[model samples]
Target: MKPGEFAGKTAVITGAGRGIGEALAKTLCREGMHVVAGDIKKESVERWKESFPEQEILAVSCDVTKAEDCEALVQTALDRFGQLDYVISNAGILHSGAVDEIDPAVWKQVIEVNLYGTFHMIRAAAPVMKAQRHGVIVSMNSKSGKKGSYKSSAYAASKFGALGLVQSAALELAEYQVRVNAICPGNLMDSPLWTEGENALGIQYARNRGITTEECRAMYDRQVPLGRTCRYEDISNVLLFLLSDDSGYITGQALNVTGGFEMR
Candidate 1:
């Protein structure tokens, strides 16, 4: 992005506590945007407050599953910055298990956090953007959104629904100049989302595929034509474009950053 292009602009980002959300928050902050970073975890948001004192970032406690909390997140941004330039719906969750093995509640939880959460934020922010007649909203989607995930049916379903929401919302908000789009990123093997915890996705995938974690990780790497896992910078570069006037004519697109792992 050009220097000062997003300077002085205000953005509200969900799931800002860790992983891709945290990475995106750092990128926007470095670009001189006022960031209202939120997460369901209060401690995570507090950590953000302590970590980025020099930057114009406001940490908020937001649970995307709750409509009221989503509204409050937007309200806080408007109250503090007075205008919302961007909304990044990056908060999401996933679980991997066979169709019959996974509990119904767990499946619903994924939908709630990944799909309903996106709706809540868009619903909350749409009016504000409409009133202003300008704004951009980007949802952190996944390549699973384009195809099914191995042993992760719930996650794929949620992302599929989110892409649908992005398209429908884009059409509805187009007259107001409020763009809605999604980023369908490939597997981010190095991200904490897949690498952390004993029950990390890498481990789960390996178990499901009857292989070792390293083998499972290597298998995915080979699937990508680029021969590498997705990177935070890859998504950020596309994000910067989506948030900039360079992509002003684009909306409702679920851009695939999959390195040819998925194509339709």
Candidate 2:
């Protein structure tokens, strides 16, 4: 983006505590936009205040699974910035297992967060964007949304539903000058979602495939036509375009940044 192109604009982001969400929040804040960053963890959100006192950021405790919390987040952005120019729905969770083996509750939790959470966010922000008559809404989707993964039924289902939401919301909000879209990233191997914690996607995929983690990573890398995994910068670049005037004519697209994986 041009220097200060987004300056003075305001944005709201969900799941701003870590990984892609945190990176997105930092990017906007650095671009001189007022960002209301919301995370489920109180301590995680609080860090934003201490980290970027010079930037305008309202870090709020939010659980996207709840509509009230979602509404509160949008209201916070309006109360602080007077107008909301962008809303990035980045909050999501993943759990992979066969339909017969995975606990029903575990499968349901993924849907609740990745799917229901997105619905709540859109339901809360759409009205405001409609009222303002101009806004950009981007959802952090994945290639799994387009095709089913071997054992990631829940994750794929949530994302597929999210795509429907993005498209339908685009149609509903387009008349009001609100653009709604989704970015389907291939995979950020280095991201905490894949690498960190005991329940990381990397570990789950490796286990389900009967391969070592490194082997699983290598397999995915080789599958990408780009011969590499997706990166945060790749996603952020697409996101910036979707938020800019250059893409003012684009809406309801689930643009693929998958190195041709999704196309295949």
Candidate 3:
């Protein structure tokens, strides 16, 4: 799409406090779209609000796992921007553990945040998009959603369910001119999701494999044909296309942005 096509548009993005969500919000705002940046952490949201002009972004403390919070996010977009033109369901958590060894509670938490969270966002945004008879929805899926991963049952399962949800939602919302799709990104090594701390996937995977996080990162980098890990801009570019008028004919599909790491 042209640079100005997104100007004056409004988008609601969950998990927008950091990582890929933050990247997307920044990119969209730079392109002139008003953004509602929602995150579970109040401080993160405040940071985002302070980063941009008040007219360009609205940062809200939101937990996508809660239906009410999801509703409030969309309402904030409408109240502040006067319309909601796009929804990006980027809120998710990662857990790496063998199916047999992982606690059921952990599995439940992953599903609750990743799968149910996507559902809540969609549930709240669908009516608004349908009423307007125009909108786009993009969910941040993962390569694991399309293929099996070592010691990633919980994360994979949640992403798999999320993809299915996007497919069904696409079919249901097609008549309303609201397109729903997903972007399955490869490893984003620089993101907090991988580099944060003990809870980070890289650290967890390294522990499970009896290796160093750096070693694990190198292994993944080699797996990608591009010889590098995914950057926030890589996913953001694809998301921009999916949400723009350029991809108006696309829907009910999960596009891969994995540097050819996954091809089926």
Winning model by lDDT: 1
Residues 140-238 of candidate 3: C-alpha lDDT, one tens digit per residue: 999988998788899999999999999999999999999999999999998998899768878887887899988999998999999999998899889
Off by over 4 Å in 2: none
Q: Global lDDT of each model?
A: 0.92, 0.91, 0.91
Candidate 1 segments whose C-alpha is farther than 4 A from its true place = none
Which tens-of-lDDT digit does each residue in 141-241 have in candidate 1?
Answer: 99889988777999999999999999999999999999999999999999987889988888878887899989999998998998999999999999999
| Per-model RMSD to reference | 1.2, 1.5, 1.3
What is the lDDT for 117 in model 3?
Answer: 98
Candidate 1 Cα deviation (angstroms), residue 91: 0.4
TM-scores, all models, native as reference = 0.96, 0.95, 0.96
Ranking by TM-score: 1, 3, 2
lDDT tens digits by residue: candidate 2, 151-227: 78999999999999999999999999999999999999999999999888889889878999999999989999899
